[model samples]
Target: MKNTLPIALSNRHVHLSEEHIKILFGEGHELNKTKDLSQPGQYACEEKIDVVGPKNTLKGVRVLGPARKNTQIEVSLADGFTLGVVPPVRDSGDLAGSPGAKLVGPKGEVQITEGIIAAARHIHMHTADAEDFGVNDKDRVKVRVGGERGLIFENVLVRVHPEYALEMHVDVDEGNAAGVKNGDMVELIK
Candidate 1:
């Protein structure tokens, strides 16, 4: 029998506050505050662009806010395709390269120099699902993403909470590198 699991592509991002944005990018840089439609307490800011990984030069991307301390830049798989890099969700301090502008507004001309960031990889599961999966909060496990681009993702942290839905979150870079698309299957390989 084939091993198959349901996977959902995370195109959503949690925002950081204005205060944290300044610390990463530097003072005087502006960050636009916006509400996250899905989750409360989550806000996005239009600030600096973060170029992750080894390749230098600006990749065509627009970083959104709220600015976070360790976790920042919420890159989509589509954006990763443009940059041609796999951005693992990680702390802001871990990101390489100088800060760049994230254009906002209608014409896509507004610029914020705060900087782009990558959040840490995590899985959110409801209480019942957590029990079914036989996992606990902060438990580390591996995820097997199957399809044309198959990969075994290791070191994925599990976050069990009543408010959360079952899903795995990865940054734009990682999604692109793995060639993951919407409605893909990601099985727990614990």
Candidate 2:
């Protein structure tokens, strides 16, 4: 039997810190949960902000909640082109030398030193799921998708944690290239 996981297409979004949230939204303002994400405790916020790059400004970018330790901006490769930024492809939270941009909210705006990135494709597996697949944390694997645009994605990272649900996340560029959508099952190529 082949091990498979559901695919989730991630679009351009921003994760804000508590301080940044207060600065962007308002003092003591809280994010309103619009929808729950596949990952536990993650949700879409009702608020949206604008991302100003050197070349152009991306308006009304959705914000994800709850606030994180540091604000991170995840954008698709196409978004990078639109913003005139060459965001490095990095794993989420691994934004050391990536690009930065100005984030504008209703109340205020923030200039991030370095946080923008084109997130790498990865699978989020629970410990039990990892055991079932015989994979470990931070393992690199390949996934094969079936369809007219079927292709094998290489160097896909595997993230294992107790709280993580079994799902594969891909940026819009990858998803469009593979012709895959949310809820589509992709086989793990060991």
Candidate 3:
């Protein structure tokens, strides 16, 4: 496992706050976990919402489980272009100054002030994994993917935590461009 990490392709998804979840799915309604994600304690919910943008609407956008402090919508650059919102490539939860969109649920609709973003590519590493890779939290590094469309990814942020598994996450666009799929191995450029 020398400088190797598995890749996970992230599609467009939404994370709702408790208040927003209540407003969207109705009072006392909790998210139904359909499947567990790579991250610990996070899951994909059975519920989905419609994201209405200035230009178009994305229907059936899956909502991630485990309510967050703020509601954030993560989209790919292509999705952003389709939605007519230029969401910045930000880390998860770094939604300040990002674009906002209208989220329509079965119960009601929520107009977020600012939460949409095109998430930056990053790696989640456990403390032991970071120690093995010689990386610290928030450290940016380059990653090499080998394939017919092989390319190097730069400025990939490292997030270190005890619960985090060692994996690299990229948007759908990035994965497609690199000709990589989920579970593909990538090398950390030291």
The candidate that achieves the highest lDDT relative to the unseen native structure: 3
Query: Which residue runs of candidate 2 sit more than 4 Å off their true CA positions?
Result: none
- Model 1, 98-122: lDDT tens per residue? 2333432222232334334445667
Misplaced by over 4 Å in model 3 are: none
* Per-model RMSD to reference: 6.9, 0.8, 0.8
Q: Report lDDT per candidate.
A: 0.56, 0.94, 0.95
Model 2, span 1-190: residue lDDT tens: 3389899999999999999999999999999999999999999999999999999999999999999998999999899999989999999999898989999999999999899999999999999999999999999999999999999999999999999999999999999999998999999988
Q: How should the candidates be ordered by TM-score, best one leading?
A: 3, 2, 1
Scored by lDDT, model 1 comes in at 0.56
Residue 137 in candidate 3, Cα distance off native in Å: 0.6
Clashing residue pairs in candidate 2, if any? none
lDDT, model 3, position 106: 99
Worst 10 residues of 2 by lDDT: 1-10
Q: Specify the highest-TM-score model's number.
A: 3
